[model samples]
Target: MELGRLLLLQVFCAALDAGTTWLMWSRIDISVVLARIAGAFLAAILIVLFCRRAPEFRGIGRFLATSISLTCLLVSYGIFALLMLRNPVLQWPLAFAAASGASLLLSWIGYWRARQGRVSG
Candidate 1:
């Protein structure tokens, strides 16, 4: 049941992210669409793997993971969108850096939270 919920949340987030990206660009490029699809696929796989490995991530821990992950994803996407709007040439590198940084920070937070939860209860 927890895994189901987590997977559902992942699907929702991925859909929202892709939809926002599509809406942001006036003219949709095939490369961008393909990239988003690939990213979404990878994210889904990661979520499934994490859920399987870290069964302790439930209740408040799960909530924290979901909220932080979603927030970071949106923020990263927003940064990318803003960069693309301002300066197209440097968008890819900067956006990738921002996304990568957010991912690392969020992963650490989730791991710490899960460990703390396990220790406490």
Candidate 2:
């Protein structure tokens, strides 16, 4: 993706993460909100880096790397959101699993769309 699009994606993802955090915590402090935004921003940078290098890998390797990066990007916010929610011990794993599953599903959809030439990046 071009630099502008990547930056836009990063900002959008960070805002989404921040919004989700605010919605979950309801009365969270500004510092925690900033932390969530920073975390998401970092994850987005890592994803962009990985995507830039993805062409170096061949076939399935490229696909897996891209997919994993995308998954992590989505899950980055969930990690903080889950921690703040602080559900019961058993529910913690369930929540994470659900988040991960959803992230994977979303990642796969994006990958499929890219493969079908439906998305530019």
- For 50-70, candidate 2 gives per-residue lDDT tens digits of 567645432234555455556
**Candidate 1 local lDDT, residue 38:** 50
lDDT of 1 by residue, 1-121 (tens): 5434544555555555455445444355554534554554455556545544565555446446655555555555555556655776764545556654665465456546655776798
Pairs with steric clashes in candidate 1: none
Candidate number with greatest TM-score: 1
RMSD of 2: 10.0
Model 2 misplacement above 4 A: 1-39, 56-90, 118-121
Worst 10 residues of 1 by lDDT: 17-26
Q: Distance from true position, residue 88, model 2, in Å?
A: 7.2
Estimate TM-scores for all models: 0.46, 0.40
What lDDT does each candidate get? 0.54, 0.51
